[model samples]
Target: MENGTNTQSEGKDPSGFLSKIIGNPVMVKLNSGVVYKGKYFTRELQSVDGYMNIALEKTEEYVDGTKRRSYGDAFVRGNNVMYISADS
Candidate 1:
């Protein structure tokens, strides 16, 4: 490319969707059937990465729909994450 510039078409990006949900409540489920409900993604998240690794504040853990415990801040590895749902 001539002046170090080029143009190409790419697909839709999900980063915008992720960014929009910052400071909102969400429920995150892990592959092990554990669920974590908390305030979702933000600067303190530490690493909301490509694998979906998550960090949260004011987190509550749930097991089989039963509240188990709470954490002031929580970190979960992305590999175990099943899905993340935003609160309505």
Candidate 2:
């Protein structure tokens, strides 16, 4: 019984994955199929549903005639994220 329950618990809490690399770069994929790579800034683990907020710094390119900079905190839904791994 215990063995079966343990298997079911795998990947149950989204925080577990993020906790491992809290201060490291973790891959974040948006619902729009956009991928972002940046160091872990901060996270809110006290939320009702364990919502993890992460700040990512990455370059942004515009289709206009000029280049611009982009960086900010992204409110990521725990379930929306596909995978999280150390930047390495």
Candidate 3:
């Protein structure tokens, strides 16, 4: 590795299913019964950290099945996230 550059290839799906949903629409459900929707997830994916926390763009927040707010960017804490799926 020269100049701090190692010629290591990244896994095609290093983030597992997340690789499929980077730009697709998604629905994220939280344990508190709150839901967030965004432009996609791999079931549709954004960015997932080791702890499973997610960062999303163009997101909307929902409560009791009603749209409550919107965010240009949003972060979902891993512990609060119940599930994430492609928006269909």
Candidate 4:
């Protein structure tokens, strides 16, 4: 078990899974339940100093399954983010 763990860690890229999705279109959901879609730009696998920076080409603020507003070309701070996934 110990050997397996070590081997897995050694083969893993330090940049992690996020590296595969950089510069791709992604959908980010914030803790407030707001969703944003845009081209991802961050290279860091994890948030930097507890903050994830994202560039948004589109944004949707949701309330009760409805979009309250929409916009384009915005920057989002990480603290509000809940999760991010590659957009199809």
**Order of the predicted models by TM-score, top scorer first:** 1, 3, 4, 2
TM-score of each: 0.78, 0.54, 0.71, 0.58
| CA error at residue 60 for candidate 1, angstroms | 0.3
lDDT of 2 by residue, 1-88 (tens): 2655655566676666666676666666655555556666544433415455455444232223243434555455655655555667
Report RMSD (Å) for each prediction in the order shown: 7.1, 5.9, 9.6, 5.3
Candidate 2 off by > 4 Å: 1-6, 43-69, 77-80
Write one digit per residue (lDDT tens) for candidate 1, span 1-88.
2477543421133355567688899888999999999996578554676777788889999999999999999988889998888876
Backbone clash pairs in model 2 (N, Cα, C under 3 Å; residues 3+ apart or in different chains), count: 0
- On the 0 to 100 scale, the lDDT of residue 20 in model 2 is 66
Q: Put the candidates in lDDT order, highest first.
A: 1, 3, 4, 2
Please state the error at residue 47 of candidate 2 in Å.
5.1
* TM-score attained by model 1: 0.78
Output the lDDT of residue 55, model 2.
51
Expressed as tens digits, the lDDT of each residue in 1-88 for candidate 4 is 2654565554344244456786677778889877777765454334433356666554555565677777766677877888877887
Show model 4 residue runs off by greater than 4 Å.
1-15, 41-50, 58-70
lDDT for model 2 comes to 0.53
Give lDDT: candidate 1, residue 48.
73
| After superposition, candidate 3 runs with Cα above 4 Å error | 1-14, 40-47
Global CA lDDT of candidate 3, please?
0.76
TM-score of predicted structure 4: 0.58
Of 2 and 3, the candidate ahead on lDDT is 3
Q: What would the per-residue lDDT of candidate 3 be over residues 1-88, giving only the tens digit for each residue?
A: 4587744554332364566667778888999999999864333244476667887779999999999999988878888988878786
